[model samples]
Target: MSLGDDNGYGNDSGRTDDAYSTIGGTRQTRTRLPDGEGGDGYNTPRRPARASRSLITMAGVVVLLIAAIAFANMGGGDGNGNDGDGSGKGGSKPEAASTAATGTKPVTGKNGTIPSGFAHDEQGAQSAASNYAVALGSAGMFSTDTRRSIVQTTHDPAVVESLVAALTKAYSPSFLKNVGLNEDGTTPSGLTFVSRTIPVGTKVTEKTGDTATVEVWCTGLVGMAGPGSTKPVSATWFTISEKLKWVGDDWRIESSSQKEGPTPVNGDNRASTADEIAGAVEGYGGFTYAR
Candidate 1:
């Protein structure tokens, strides 16, 4: 179900509190209209053998359609997996920059005396942007104090206040209630709330000295991953483009925008039980992302 500001997937500047549930899986089954009346206790007219042939033909058509869908899914949507691969543009420079470069590394220097240094070059900037995106889109952003700290620390000083205000309004009381969370961002009893963005890859779409715009095409794991949980965590893919500026010796996000991904189909992995999933979340702590 989508909730709480498109789950922070966009920058449209409005609180869109909407939620939806997928009954079974991501895809919904088509419901067929039931027969109104059974052919009363009498034998219905025997249809011609040709009618049976038509039914068989119809079934064959459906089978072909299903096969096509499966084949397409097997290829996956080519969503950006740690790079611009999902963009359907092959040999793109940004996608290949990291691997193609022989001897280049991010220039790390103290920015505003903050702990983590910013990447100095375009390549470094792209890497930094990708990792930063992961942290911002993480589940930790849901907790009240943590969320505030994250916004303040991760965002550019020039934009932090505005972003915070917008995020504050977006994650309002009503919004939290709809997502099954309290006004203070606490999870309901016996349920764990989860949200995290996993960066598949980074690409420097456009760059210049000390300032560049990089797009981190990412596949994120979100939702509550646990047992007896009404809202089990799920995944979503999107591209977050960030404009970065070298400030006090570091790259910082000045402004940003998000777009829906070239999402792919679900793989054939076995679905774990709720208890097992919950245990995994508790047992595992996410990483401090870097490109």
Candidate 2:
């Protein structure tokens, strides 16, 4: 997903300057004459007054303008609400705490199946893609059985077998140990392995019926949390672009690619003690994403 302005336009200042230059010069300003509107200082010709509009006529024009505006909005008025929050109508909805506090609804199929339940809207697609990225990057992908399950659950069934095989080769034993896990992908005794992906947001690069290319940019905690641990869990950021198909009643990835971080700097807060980190890791649980 692209992480840039969805509006794809310049700001008001640029618009204003362009409009002014079009009309006259860029520095042009509006100024009323001293005798403007024929006050006591009136020197300009006393312009002929026109007949006043009938109240009914004025009211009719106002009603017509309002109706026209409503019609345009119904068709698609750029998705921006009058509230100025940048979130469109689909994004400004309420959400469940268990699924994350994002103000968006779960993607649902028309018949309550996979990608089908997804909102046939951009925000819904973005939300779905983001969660899918997290589940794809999880530590579960390192184990053969769990890796197959993860891929099958999150990917289009038609491509699952091949993708699973590719992933199995990608997450080698050495790669697991390099990230602070044993060759078998388990943490050593007294340490809790931490490999969880949390998505910050998503962007849709392209879309069409039954297909979309989306990028889910995520920050993850990966490592071991235990006493005397030299390698504590830390964050990594990456973007996972997924090619999706509307399958099993929802969007499923056909394939995905990951890239390194554009991550922000870490804060100076004191790090949690190793024991505290281990306890927290054991006590807390992760999420089962929908939208």
Candidate 3:
């Protein structure tokens, strides 16, 4: 591209900057001083003292930017295992950042269809809470026998009966109808019901000898998916707080409660059709989550 001498900073000008500077990862064109107010004669222009000074100033700014980037690039760990900028690498270290992955393996046992045999530790409590959240929000929870089985398997024996009764009432026939299910909680012949919870993260709020209070942040899909479905599958976010007790060599929920989310702004993606949503749920399997 040629911007003739009408602009004094043109290539014909002696003080042109041919290179671009990258700042904050984006390239920017170098700024040039405007044309000198007046010149010597027909075509011989005199560059003022300020023009030279401005060139020097531009060079100084470039140097400072380079130095700043070099400082940031030396992202080395300090003696105390933190980056010089006070952020850790957040990797496989004993004292990793609070939000870093712990690199623990998934639990290998199952209590019926739900995960079981969690370690008798804080991580175990968190894992149990997360899996229990999945169970409590699942399609199985909408059915009577399966709901009883899941409740009995995951909840503390002392509270199982009462919780079952309470949950049964909560999923009354009217409630089932409201969610687009049959009075008995079955989907219509051509429809598929989706009620699955996915744990986003877990945290231990209180831990002691044999009890732990864990809060699992979760997102879930719910409703009916099929042709002519009035209630299409939709997403929800909530936190399930589980009071866990270490029993039978594993963690079990003594009680659990839920609250509305730290919801995020919706994205611009188009919503899938009922059949598409139903097909994806059938095709994909959930993870055996680990902390």
Candidate 4:
């Protein structure tokens, strides 16, 4: 299913400088005129005059160099040093908040490969949402029994029954056929049914002692993989917003909704063949996502 398509179904270089002049090895002798002859020429000695001029030139060069360095450090050279919002005067702008892992250990508990026993705090809520997204978007959701297990495990107990019923109808025979699966939700022989969600990140938008609203940004591969398969494996990006409650000493999903992506531009990489896609999906396992 598309993230939004959960009709009762589960959703979601530098330079250098130089100075000075040189002369032949032998110093030129200077003829001194009497103290006040002509030319301010009391033999004031030309070497010191030349040396003073050289020193001034070198000082000017140094000043210019310092100014250039300061400008660069202030991000005047490239705009990257400036915070996009214009709040920073860069000496290395603070890193923008990111979805990168916070180094918190992921939930180690599992209910049949689906993560469980999430902590009751905000991080736990986010972790719950992300893992729930994966479970809800998995290929198992196409089958009745597995789907029931997933719903029962991840959803609030109060709502599990109704959700199971709705999802059963949502994955009706027609829907299964449309997605290249059989009446019983199994792939045709030699074909691999692919329905996997990879969570890009999770954010807790609102939270309280017992409730949280989280948004999981995700990308998914759905459809079938095989020779001549009409519904080739394809990727979609979307966000799943779930309301979670602290229930049974762990976080469970209360409800969820989805929408189209905060998608990024596609890369220019070559698309893989169906066999290759199938192999990759089968070979690589998923992760326990955490915020």
Candidate 5:
């Protein structure tokens, strides 16, 4: 759920000067005794050996210095960068994409109850994670039919069956009863079972052409809403991490996990009555998320 060598100086006059090479901040001084002296050179010096032995040492040091600087530059990168030409990694990458709205329209289609037609890009991955979190956290996950639909619609085909089985086992009769639902996962005659996720924000923590890891920070409603309901609807805060594969032109979750949140302190507002909560839920429609 959450979370690894030379520097040289050369003097003129064809004299092999005693060479000092700094590699990785460690300086090495070598005494070159003409061609008879033994030393490791990174490259063959243009000048003849006896005269250019120190130059060779310098060349080796220069090569190492460049390599060290290059390695240093490549070290601290976020590993999500690309050269504009797409030929290398960790070039002068553009500024990180902001989490604020990008003005792009949200997806306009649905894969059954789930949103479809997400873009084949990072934004699309974020959207998929957000919407999938909502579907997975919703009341549909408690019902067998809708649960299967939610799992199949959002999960990668390779794992859909397994997820379905696991979720079915997890939402057993006792679990349902504990949550005030009927053994069959139905709402009681006078009660409305509320379970819905609202994504506060979505982030693409990792991304590639065909795979992505997105984290969706969410707040959800979970409980029963009706008069005399002991399980009154309450708000929950958490984050959902979704590993998505670009499967068949759309993002499907390969795996998913949840963790308790960066939740805020409880507010002082009075709790709404069960009837009011149910009415508000029915009156409010969910949304299709986007970057």
Candidate 6:
């Protein structure tokens, strides 16, 4: 699986200065009153009082506007604003650890490169599903023998026979050819067939003593890599939902299906050349993913 406005201030400042000027002008007018005029003769006009009140109201409004802007900038963390962290739920929950290292030990036992002997707990179930996703999405699936081994090893024993037959039919010679593989699922001469699934994370959707459903977010690279290759390797992100059963003392897939992605926005990184991609695929090994 592949895993995946501005503010104008110039006129406003002038208006603010005008307000201050009005208050200053009112004070200057008051100072100009006759020195010994009658007590009621120099009464300040209601206009100045109204202007003061209006100024207070405008200041209050400005304060409120500033507070609103600051609150918005702070995001309030109320689960409504998009923080763009890819949780897509705003700030409601801490971002799901899509690609963070879990620090959990990977499975030690393997059934021919497909992890086996999972612990039969929620973690184990998730681990099993993720690793199974990698196995099923690997270039091995294009071949007969490796595909059979993967199916038999990762699938529940009760359904292995049916799954093998079905998967075999699904990966027909025509399909292999379309993917730039030979009739026997081998890559053509001087070309490297790349089909690798890197799980970003796993979530247990449902779990019980003997059964569990897990979603593995994954990014996959598939196609042939070589000069002048028609099918250059490309990446795709998808989520694989696996229904697993505690069979034969370990988690095994009962059924699994894939959906297109919780894909992240593309970055501006330069795409690597075909040879570079092929070499990377060949050099770097995959991980045994856990929750």
TM-score of each: 0.65, 0.57, 0.66, 0.67, 0.67, 0.65
The residue pairs that clash in candidate 6, if any, are: 1-218, 1-219, 2-218, 2-219, 2-220, 3-218, 3-219
lDDT scores in order: 0.41, 0.40, 0.48, 0.48, 0.49, 0.46
C-alpha RMSD by candidate, in order: 15.2, 24.4, 26.4, 30.4, 26.5, 28.9
Question: Number of backbone collisions per candidate, in order?
Answer: 5, 14, 0, 0, 3, 7
- On a 0 to 100 scale, what is the lDDT of residue 197 in model 4? 65
| Model 3 spans > 4 angstroms off | 1-96
Which run of 10 residues does model 1 get worst, by summed lDDT? 62-71
TM-score-sorted candidate list, best first: 4, 5, 3, 6, 1, 2
Q: Candidate 2: give its CA RMSD in angstroms.
A: 24.4
Candidate 6 residue spans exceeding 4 A from truth: 1-103
Tens-place lDDT per residue, model 6, 180-212, is: 678777888987866556666666666667987
Ranking by lDDT: 5, 4, 3, 6, 1, 2
lDDT of 4 at 231: 56
Best by lDDT: 5
Q: Could you give me the TM-score of model 4 versus the true structure? A: 0.67
* Candidate 5 overall lDDT versus native: 0.49
Error of 2 at 171 (Å): 3.4
What digit string (tens of lDDT, one per residue) describes model 2 on residues 1-291? 011123221112111111001000000010011212212221232222211111110000000000000000011112211221223222333234533445665544322121335665556566666555544444454456755665566557865564444335434576555545688867688777555556555555566677766655455554456765545544444444555667756676554433334568766566666677678867887553444
lDDT of predicted model 6: 0.46
Better structure of 3 and 6 per lDDT: 3
lDDT of 4 by residue, 1-291 (tens): 121223232322011111111000000000011112222221132211122111110000000000000000000012111222221222333256765677889888888877888887877888887777666666665568876786687767876675455445544677566545798878899877666666676666566679877666666555456665555555555555566778878888665444445668777666677677778878998788877
